[model samples]
Target chain A: MEITSDTHSQHISKQFNHELEELKTHLMAMGGLVEKQVQDAIEALLEGDSRLAERVRDNDKVVNDMQIKIDEECTRVLARRQPAASDLRLVLAVIRATSDLERIGDEASKIARNALSLVEAGRSPRGFVEVRHISEHVRKMVRDALTAFARFDTQLALSVVREDESVDSEYTTAMRSLMTFMMEDPRSISSILSVMWILRALERIGDHADNLAEYVIYLVKGLDIRHTDPDQLDDEAIQGKS
Target chain B: MEITSDTHSQHISKQFNHELEELKTHLMAMGGLVEKQVQDAIEALLEGDSRLAERVRDNDKVVNDMQIKIDEECTRVLARRQPAASDLRLVLAVIRATSDLERIGDEASKIARNALSLVEAGRSPRGFVEVRHISEHVRKMVRDALTAFARFDTQLALSVVREDESVDSEYTTAMRSLMTFMMEDPRSISSILSVMWILRALERIGDHADNLAEYVIYLVKGLDIRHTDPDQLDDEAIQGKS
Candidate 1:
């Protein structure tokens, strides 16, 4: 009887582990979709492809579905497994990461909307090269953040956090240049505002990526580093863990 | 011996219930603090009070602390109790709500930072009256969302979700006006850009608040209303709950 019971319990534990692994896989899948969404949204804007922008908008439904499925899977695991400590932390971190990913999807949708508007209104003064630069950095941040979360790599996560400042600077610079361009040619105000909105969306995507990296660090090191100075994160992260 | 065992179990269950209640009360407290932070941040911008803006920046630490405390309490409860079903839902909802609340604080800080920049740059056009209108709507949405969550009122939550569209419209209108104003007068571009960022922050605050309301609906009804049509939320929420 004892041997049978031990084997039964082992089976249950294996099931639980399998479910958790499934949850992580789903999250990573969702992350991949989000990255593609961001890339496509930027391309739609740069090329003034309203049809491509509409495609990005439509793809958002898929991203939102992934978020809903991942969340349900998480709650199911929590309800069934009753996981503690690191397992519980991992589940919560996934939930936090999903929120960021969903928001990133929303940002992508916003960018796509602006792209459609710019296309309809007629694009003017075609130079948002700085926004393109920022988009490159933003994409890297999201990719690094998802990788860090997947591998439990605190160092990669911290580097993602550090990249946020550069993205932010890029945003500021882009805004300044755009403002001057709009002022220099009033005819471009409508279209330029659309570009500004798209740039804002990209900058926001970077911020959400940074937040995801922080969640990764929190999951790996058991440190709540959301509002901490990026410079101080390495020290605090090392000092805190259970 | 059986009698004592039953009594002891009942006592422990009551203690768990009490702890859950305390967690809720603490969440309400945090909600109140976030609402005040949003208000103060907007006030700083509208009044051009650098001192008030500085105070809002300083108070963000308190907001961050509340989020950490609430999150720690949530993780502890989940680990200790292994709550299932609605009990599990409540804890996860609180965790999600805390993140939105914390982000509201971050947006508030961003608003304050922009307020300071605008103040230092010597106030753009003095009439951010449209931004004031948007701020009023955002504040209402936050207050209503928290109340909806606290009371488990799906009707209120649905309304908050619907209100988001109006906020989005207001943001678009404000942007158009700001862009036209910036183009009409080149010298004011720098200061007006600050106001534009502040408006964007407020618009984002409304979005986060709408998300919080959806989480409340999810918790109360066990249906994820996120990414759903706001028009459809009322019916779906009513149909799905206990």
Candidate 2:
């Protein structure tokens, strides 16, 4: 249950440690807001709540502002604290994670927009099953990615990475079925395409979550495992390849 | 065509300036590689050259490697040099731009994959015109965004941002037509769907380019212009509203 090294706590200045903690707290707040955005956007789509979808669309600005705010704070920390080693990585990781979180928010808004179109069309496509399934899957991945980040848990982060592969496969399966459905019923192509887009958004949300998890691994282990073979990632990264 | 401020050159230590210059060069190299990747991927899709598409897919690793390398250098610069103000912005911009460029590379690879699929399917569908048009448009935007970074030209960067809006509208128009085309000729549905994906990929490439341009503006003006209203971005950003 011991956190790895507790490096942040080892800083000589309590004020410096407090600043890093505050930076992370802000990042976690951003993560929380983005997660709610994704959840609300998906709920609006499934429940045909156009009103909720509109709110999700509007709330994307808040996520954007958070990214700007956190990035400014990171620059300030780097300028003032001149943090080295693990502290530096923590700031860099927050920068990268916020970027991913902001993109996740953008995708959530895109999903909400598609949901609005689908609602106005007033025809629920047959792929809501896939939508619901994948949304829940990716939302968990996002939540877990954040948790891994909060705890500096490489195991949980790796699990998020592994889950992304399954999410990709699920996306493929959903795409194939939807394509078949469209070819079977040409009249459904328009609405089905909108569903396809929403599915695509969810799949991308999963990807952003995957990126967040990778940042966690990078922060904890100092290994930039991005674009590495996922098969080799587990043994090497967790076992301290670097 | 004087570059703005020449703040990077103002650093007192010649060695530090050299390091910053070297980082910029590596980033430009990565930028050039990604631009070619997009260009080649679109050519493969248009000409049915699976060989070229395969090369583009494999070469994404170089782009990935460049991101990690550049990032490490940035971290070192931040940790060792503890660069403040404009020198700091230059490093941060390189970091952010590399991430955008890497994603742009990923999208190019996806386009190449879809290109391979389109070639194997043996049906070119009816959307090649739009493909050629949009690909050329976005390739120029990518080039301009990189040029903006190299020259510290916010004006060029803003132009790239404006071009993205047109590219997006072009994509929307193409999507509508392709949707209609599929509806009219159900037999073309499968090949046309692949074309749709390629178009989608191209649209996303433009988005990444837009992001790169935004980073340039941020580096030069210290303005976080992301998620801003595009219409107002010109007056506020260019007029030195930080």
Candidate 3:
């Protein structure tokens, strides 16, 4: 009797561990898919590849389906497991993070659509160089933010948040350059508007990355640092590094 | 004994009905608060009232707190009552709607902050006329979308979705006009950039209103119309006088 009871307990424990691992795996898979969407969207813009743009639009379905699946799974876990404390927080954070990821997908799709249209309009203006600079910076921020998320590196996430200011500055310069193109020729207004839309999409992608980084901080420290100064975060590791 | 049992069943039913009513009332209250935030945010832009903008920002805390409370209430009801079918759908819809409402509150707060900055910077280069035009259209969309939500008027919601195109077109025009100003005088770039940001926020608000309208359609029809052509929805209600 004792031997049988022990075996049953072992089986139950294994089941519980499996469930946790499965949830984690699902979240990471969803993250991987969303990261690819963002990366490919950027590549499409850089290469002016309309086929890649169409792929981005088509892949949005997969991203959205993943969001719904993850959400349902989280709900099921919450309802069945009655998780408390850290487990509960993890589930809640996943819910919010998945939402941010889905939104990032939406923004990427917008960027791809904008890129497709811009490329179709033939050659862009001479000042498109400034947009390229802004896009590069924003892309870097997005990549680092996702990397920080995958590794749960709050310090790296904080740095990504700080880099947003530079992206904003670059965006400002691009806007001025685009504006100059518009004012010089009314005929250029249509083309300039397309570039402006693309810049707006890139800036928003950066904003969403900052949001993801904020979620990372919340998950690690159990603090809602949104709308608060990042300097307030006590980074012992960073202090030691300095 | 039979009479006593019958009375006991009646009392239980009364209690259940009361709880359901309470849940509905709380959800509606949350909606009201969110709708007010959107209205005030746009009003702040139209009137250039920094005080109103500040109020919108401050009130976001209430909206966020209400979200947490409503979420807890939803889960508690689900656990205690085991609602199914339409009741289940209603609860789920309320949960999703509250989330959208809270996000709308966030968007409004963002708009208000942008407006405050614009006011502090003196006059915007896009001119008050264009700002007013965009603000009025978006506000109307928000009001109509919320009305449709409250009434479950799919017809009205579909119209609101149609109106989003007009808002998008207006945004495109605004971008082109701002680009012209920037190209004409590089010095006006900063002011024009701020104006474009404000317009972008307004455009986003309109997009959210469209999202809310889509939710209304989903709640009423159990159809996911997102990313699909609105014209494809052949329901008589969605077709509505078109």
Candidate 4:
């Protein structure tokens, strides 16, 4: 029934794709908000700004609303258009990427809550400067992942996927240092645990960003590259391109 | 074009719905696997079963495959049938629920890894019995969430959502105790931190379960109750029913 050749049919098809495009725009908007929230949530902790943390926390509802609206739009389009192959992949990718972005928003909220906890505990948390050092890598990973997804650049997506490993190693290093610090200084154990939790949240943000990049590869190549090692991904990329 | 009363059209529609039913059956099967993984992962921690922990970690690939396959089926159905309204809701819910299930699997893997870390750390890790008590509530929440989703029982979904609050309170209590224990005896800090991470994973599993129940409400009534407070959900659920 969708295999029509009429001019009217062609016009309708174009609008259908335009709807997919609109869906992407909404996804990017949501991505943009999540990106800002992550940045501010980390900064609020590193700088110990409860006021800024409160802002990040309150903006969570906006991100949640955008997620609902974007989901509704995706559902509407799937019902009306019934797109095939690549277009179908793109719509599915958008639905998934939106969920990842919303989760990124949730992680940001967690970071802010941890920040407020440290601030209200009436002492500046130790090793927050160290936490910032660790968070920078995750922040860049998130930014680059969003860029790759928007551009559909498999190369960039691949790079983001690879970056996740280094970020994960950095997480291990951070956790080790936190654990050591906790033992050596019992006076600061509570605050150190808070810092550890914040870093854990950042590490997870990197993970969600990594998952987002995988969706980009899946969108482009129509292959499941998840659970595959980054070293293997390089070979898979060559094969996919060839 | 789908708006037809002809016999052939009715037959095609029936086939489409059969596809949806098939998708549901697959989802339930995947849910069953994930549930077992969660149970085994926690037991690996509680009982210090390194062998079981490794098994849970290794089985992650199976869960990942199920998630990808289910997602592909949803995309195919959307591209072919373009189901509207309730049917559209059903497919979208399946896709979303599959992701949650996959995440639950990932968290299970994380828990398993934490268990191995404790086992390798060569310490039995105190406070684990307490951690088991906390995880019990989460495990039940997950079991009931899947039950509610597969049965399309909104009442059960509401209870799952309400149960999350108690699980959350237990998480807080457990965390506070863990922190106190860590500070009092720094010798066990390393193993204790791993236990804390496992407990954190359980709390998140509870959250994912809560999200699953929300999807049921979304599928049944087209209402987004994600950001709403549970106390208010009671009133909202009554309104949604009428």
Quick one: best DockQ, which candidate? 2
Worst 10 residues of 4 chain B by lDDT: B233-242
In candidate 4, how many Å is residue B85 off?
A: 1.5
Tens-digit per-residue lDDT, A82-122, candidate 2: 89999999999999999999999999999999999999999
Ten contiguous residues minimizing lDDT sum, candidate 3 chain B = B82-91
What DockQ does every candidate get? Answer: 0.68, 0.72, 0.18, 0.71
Candidate 2 stretches with Cα past 4 Å from truth are: A1-12, A234-242, B1-12, B234-242
Q: Cα RMSD to native, each candidate?
A: 2.2, 5.6, 5.5, 2.9
Residue-level lDDT of model 4, residues B1-242, one tens digit each, is: 44556877889978997999999999999999999999999888878899999999999999999998998898888878878888888998999999999999999999999999998888886777777787788888888998988888888889999999998898888888988988889998988899898989998999999999999888888787888888876655533553
How many clashes show up in model 2? 0
How would you class the docking of model 1?
Answer: medium
Query: What are the per-residue Cα lDDT tens digits for candidate 1 across A67-156?
Result: 999999999889988998788889999998998999999999999998898888876454468768888999999999999989988878
TM-score, per-candidate, Cα-based: 0.94, 0.94, 0.73, 0.94
Clashes of each: 0, 0, 2, 0
Q: How well does candidate 1 match the true structure in TM-score terms?
A: 0.94
Candidate number with greatest TM-score = 1
lDDT of 3 at B34: 79
CA lDDT of each prediction against the hidden true structure:
0.87, 0.92, 0.74, 0.87
Model 3 per-residue lDDT tens digits across residues A54-125: 999889999888877777776666655655545555666676677777887888888788778877887555
